[model samples]
Each structure stands twice: as C-alpha cells, then as structure tokens.
Target: MQPDNSQPKTKPKIASSTTDPVDFDHAIGPDTSTPDGRREIRRATAASAMGNMTEWFDYGVYAVAVTYISFHFFPTEGGTLMALGTFALSFLVRPIGGLVWGPLGDKLGRKHVLALTIVMMSLSTFLIGVLPTFEQVGILAPVLLVLLRMVQGFSTGGEYGGAATFMAEYAPDKKRGFLGSFLEFGTLGGFALGTAVMLLLQVGLGDEAMMAWGWRVPFMLALPMGLIGWYLRNKLEDTPVFQELEERGEVQQHSSLASLIRGYWRPMLVMSGLVIALNVVNYTLLSYMPTYLEGQLELDPQASLMVILIGEVAMMAVIPFAGSLSDKVGRKPLWIGSLVGLFVLALPLFWLMGRSFPLAILGFAILGLLYIPQLATITATFPAMFPSHVRFAGFAVTYNVATAIFGGTAAIVNEGVIDASGFLLFPAVYMMAACLIGLLATRYMPETAGASLRGTAVPDAHDTGILADADA
Candidate 1:
C-alpha cells in the first residue's frame, strides 16, 4: 500500500515527567530555517561525515591491499581465503559492540559514543600497519591481525549508527535527504582516497616495495584522519532531537535493547531486511570488487584497482544528486528503482566486465550508478525507521546483525561458491538475490522524507502530508 502522507490534526502525546517538563521547541538546536542555523547544520554534517570517512578508509585500504595481507600473514595455500575470512571475522563481534554501545549512545549521547568509537577504530587500524608479519612472528602474526580487525569491527558497530543518527537529527526536516548524502559522500571519499593512495604507492614504490612496506603507509594515515574527525566531532553538540529527549527525561536510562526488541521489533526486522540488500551490494561493490576482479576474473591487480577506483568515483559523483532527488520524489521510489535496476542488470554488467579493460570500467561504472540511489539515501532512510530514543540501538543492532551475516562474509561467500561450482556469474546471482530481499522490505518501508523526527513516535508517511509525488 502507498503511504498516506496527510498530517494529523494534533501532535502525538509523548510520555514525560510532570515535575521536570521542558519546552520542546526550545530544546531543539539552532533554527535551521535561518542562515546561521544552516551554517551550523553544514558543520554538523562535515563532523559526522568525517568520522565516517575515517572509519571506512581503514576498510578500503584493507580491501584493496588483501593480496599483501594474505602474503604477509597467511600460509601459501588458501592464503587469500584466510585474509577474506579475517575480514569477515571482524564482523562477528559487531553485534556485541552494538549491544554494548548502541544503548550507551541512547543514554550517554551520540557525540560521546562516536568520539570513543572513532578513536578505537583509528588506533586499531593504525596498529595493523605496525604488526609483525608471519615470517617475523610465525603463528602470532595472523593472530594479531585478527585481533585488531575485531577491535575495528567492535568500534565500527557504534560509529556508523551514531554518525547517521547525528547527521539526520541535525539536518532540517525538509533537507535531510540532501544533507545526509554528504555523510555517504565522505564514505566514497574515504574509499577513493584509500584506493588512490594504494594505487599511487603501487606505481611509485614498485610492486616489491608495496609488498614489503608500502601497504602499511595507507593504514598509518588512518590515525591522523581519525584525529581530524575527532576534532570536528568534538566541536559540535549532540543532535537536537537527542537533546530534546534528554531535556524531557525521555532518554533511555536503562537497557534499551530489551525495550527495542519488545517495542520496536517490526521496524528492527524491516531495517534488517533492507540492510541485507544494502550491505551485500555495498561490500560486494566497494570492498570485494578488487578481489573478485583480480582473483576470479583473472584481471591484473592494477587493472582491478583502476576499475574499482573509477567506479567508486563515479558513484561518489552521483550520490549527492540521488540524495537530493530522494527529497523531492521520496526515498522509497529511488530505492525501488535501484533494487529493480540492479536485479535486472547485475548479470549483464558482470558479463560485460569480462569482455575487455574499457568494458570492465564501463560495466562497473554502470553498476555503481545504479547503486547510488540506495547508497545515497542510507542516512536519510534508516535512522527514521525508529524514534529518537531507540534510533541508535535500533539501527546499530539490526544493521550490524544483518551485515555480520551477509555483508562482512560477502567476499568469502562469493569466492567459496564460485570456487565450488565454477560458476563465473555467482556474484551477480548473489546480488540479485539480495536485491529481491531489499525490494520486499522497501515495499513496506515508511516514507519519511521531510517528516519531522523531533518526537518519540515513529516517523511515518501516513502521519504527515505528502511532500511530493512520484514524478516530483
């Protein structure tokens, strides 16, 4: 059924303490309708996006440098699989991190939790650069890498949910889609920066040097990038919606997980379904593409990197426009279009990719652009699924759980299935399956574009007037 967007006659009643009532309007941050308010919103966007960029830079570097990682850390036989497995291993602990940090962000505030998570993520990423190789430490080398990856995963569990919530709450109701896209802009920026850095080093230092130590340089840069993100985040205040919750004593003081499962299970399940598609496509295109191109398709390492780099840049360029478009036309339509498009084209594009070098770039670029609608609207769509109180935990727990199951393991799953069946189109088939799941979820997803996120009530398209038509 299409969402009913008519506004209700009265505001929903929020549970609040009578003795300590706070003015809701006053609790919200600077007036976003004003120029000064808009400036502050932009700053908040940058701070949130920077932390995200810092986090993904690590993943990007790790993904592109998997060959070196396998060589240095694992045995000759099944080394690539081991590296991919380690990559998946980090995701195993993300749910635990979410369980711990998500509720804390609800109780403690988004900024505090985000600050701590970024530091942990960056430090662990930096430490990977300094870890001893298998030749140096025998069995302990891979062990250390695995441990740090877990730390990165644990920290990331909190980082993304908090950042998205932070960006969403700070943005004006009308412009949330446009502003939120910048956070993902930072996402592709990080991946592009990391890929570009790795490529440059591979070219300048030669393959021998890159294998020896050049890969470490990209990991090391994560520290300073993290520090800058920390600085930017520290300069800002918590989201206005969160502040309003705090002022009214609505912030969850105890375990939010139990409450989340009991009260908001429907949205949690829906979000999880959406995430399955989102991250499968996400990890496949951004994280696993280089490996698939190089290992499965028999493309050269440099050529694979070039393909990924070009595709990512193209996606980055289109992301903001897609995000802005979501505001006018609504998020569900863009998502539906994207899922359907990818489902239809995944096979053809993957086939085209095998034809030649230029075709590979063209195929990847087309797939990436098809993916932009979903990628661009992530921050705008997911956080609005729950109210301010459980938004962090709701998003963190479900997203991490689904991501751990399907996303983090995407590379290994694709590689294993193809290795077993000798089916070259397995990845495309896998992505098509995920897109089907996403389409089902998107059908039921509430349209929240231009909807106010100020209250504890779940934002719904039915509760507010339609901002625009499908053609708008």
Candidate 2:
C-alpha cells in the first residue's frame, strides 16, 4: 500500500486528440516540479489539505454545536425546527456556491481566491460565537444568523472545488490517488478534530452547561484558522496543470453553468451517481451515526461519539494506504471491493450498533475502512474525467449538486425513516442501493486516478488501458 518502489517508473502517454495536447516536460514555475510534474502535485496537495480541513472543520463544528446554538438563538417553542432548518438551509446554498466558485477557480488562480474564502469563513465563525440571541433582540437574531450562514456557504463553495481541482492538477501521473487523497485526509482530520472537540466539551461540561456557553468555544476556535490557512497557503504556487491551461488560454470563463453545458456536462452527470453513492454511505455512517446511535439505539451520546472518534482514527491511517494501493492494484477493483463489502456488511453492523457498545464500535470501524475508496481515489480520478478547462467546473458542480440533494438531507431522512419504520434496517437498504449504483458506474467509466488531468473522457479500450497504466 505504501508507494510501490517495486513498480516500473515509466510515464504512460495519453491519446492524441484535438482537445488533448502533447505531453510536455515540466516547465518553470514558482514550485519546483519534476520532469513528469510530481512536485506540483506535492505542493498542491499540501495547500489543498489546509483549505479542505478548515472548510470542513467549520461546517462540522456548526453541525455539532447547532443544538447548543439553537438553545441560545431561537425561540424556545420553535428552536429545534429553526435549528434544523438553519442547517438544511446552509446546505441548500452549497450548489450555488459551487456554481459561483468553479468558473472563477478555472479562470483566476485558485490560491488567491481560496485565501479570501478562508478569511470570510473565519470571521463569520467568530461572529457566530459572539452573536446576540432572539430573546434579547427578537426575530432579527435568527435572520442575522441565517445571513452569516449564507456567507459561510458562499466561501466554502469555492474552497472545495478550487482545492480539489488544485490537488488533482499537481498529482503525479502514477501516484495521483495516493497524493490527492491527502486532501481527503485533511477533510476527515478536520471533521474528526471538530467533532472530538465538541464531544470533549460535552463530556467536560455536560449538555446543560454546553448549551449555555461551551458550544460557542468551537465556533470561536475557527478564528485562529484564518491565520493558519493564510500562512499555509502563502508560499504555495499555482498548479502546473492549471498554469498550462492559463498560458494556452483554455481556461473556462463564462460561468460554471455554461462550462457544464458546453462540453463538460456528461462528466458532471457521471459524478452525480458517484456523489449520491458516496454521500449516502458516508453521511449515513458518519454525520448521522452519532445521533442515530444515541437516539434510536438508546446509547450514551458520549459513547457514540467515542465510537465514531475511534473509527475516524482508523480512517486517518488507512486512507493514504488505500489510495497508494489503488495506484498499483487498480481503482476499479478497490471501488468494487469496498462497495461489495459495505453492501454485505451494512445491515448486520447497523443492527449491532443498537445491541451493544463494543459491537457498535466494531461496526463503525469497518464502515470507516470502507470509506478508504473515496478518501483515497476520488480526488485523483474525478477531475481527470474532464478537460483542465472544465475540470473545476465539472468536479465541483456535480459533487455539490449531488451533495445538496443527498448529503444535507441524510440526518433528516434517516431519522425520519427510523421514526416511521421502527426498524433499523431501512438505512441498510439505502447503503446497499448506493454502493450498487457506485459499483456499476466504475465498471462503465475508465479509471483516471493520478493520470493527466486534461485527458479525454469516454475513451476506447486502448485509451482506457492508457488511463489504467497512468494511475498511481
């Protein structure tokens, strides 16, 4: 799973097409890139990781601390509804964020814009921590809260697409999956850090005290990220792949919507299924799991958090390994294997979470491992499915659109199903269906992990072999 020193280091040549340019040696850039463009990948991955971590960290903290904030911000009678509504509404804006951010990343450089976004997110988060309540200021309080969330939404929309595209461009021809997966690790790391901090506060200060003041701590913590994100991104250079597109005047400029319609639309459609399968399985198991276990399964909230915390720890270690292995063994096999395992395992393990603490922990650990497919490969592969001009637009819009539909609704839907069905098995059915759809998609689409980011989509067999050979 570690970078395979045993494999031949030859670079695979992509097919020639009007759209596809001839392979070029690494040209001069602020970052030192290797002959085949490996250094750019490393720098891109590092910078992108910082961006992704902060984006998810702020969002995760908001979700974890929402109940606490609702207690302070909304009317007592309607607080829960207002809280859930606020969270859902924030997600509703993500697609719009993707739309606005994508073409900009494609047009302007990713580094400058992403830095601006970090500053917006940090300020918004800090303001949330210090904001006044409706009890003191009336309905205006909730309105102001919603407004702040919109700004956060707009900022994150750009952060994700830009970061993902940035990493994809720099990834080495053979090692894209492993290297790009560091971005996923950053996401998981941020979420884990945020959730762990929330839970630590819950354990340290009980819910009563937490709702009173402790919840504000996590939101306020984001203020420091402004300095950190800006610092990390300061020395980074533009992605070489992107730089090439900029020089050639191939970067998309109209709108993310126009780019998606012109030539990049099909890849966006492909990613729709991809995101559905991914978000359904991931959110069902992660974001919804803690509440599901504590509420439905009648376990301790702290215990459920601890279980997921352990699972997240396992994920931190396995993601890079899985990405690296996909570089050698091929992405399709890993994708199919993980899905099949989850298909078989979902029902039984979810049931066990309702039965005992240890079983719940074990079940979640396996679920975390299953996510290595996404954590390691998607960043490298999905953007490679589009031309450099549309890669940002294609990858971000499709992902955010699908996520808007499925990911944001996960907690509400799963809780609703459990509320209605009285059976824990329904979520398992959802998982099975998602994994199946994902499995079928891989069989049809060729692997693109860590290959040239600007390759043509829908290639024939020989080109497919070229893509497979290019994967790291």
What tens digits encode model 2's per-residue C-alpha lDDT throughout 251-294?
A: 65565376366665656776777777888887777676766776
* Per-residue accuracy of model 1 over 291-384 as CA lDDT, tens digit each: 9899888999888999999999999888999999998888999999999999999999999998888999999999999999998999999999
- Total clashes, candidate 2? 4
- Model 1's alpha-carbon lDDT is 0.88
Ten residues in sequence with the least summed lDDT for candidate 1 = 18-27
Give the runs in model 1 whose Cα sits over 4 Å from its true position. 1-27, 466-472
C-alpha lDDT values of all predictions? 0.88, 0.72
Clashes of 1: 2
In model 2, the clashing pairs are 41-170, 174-472, 176-450, 327-472
Error in Å for residue 347 of model 2? 1.0
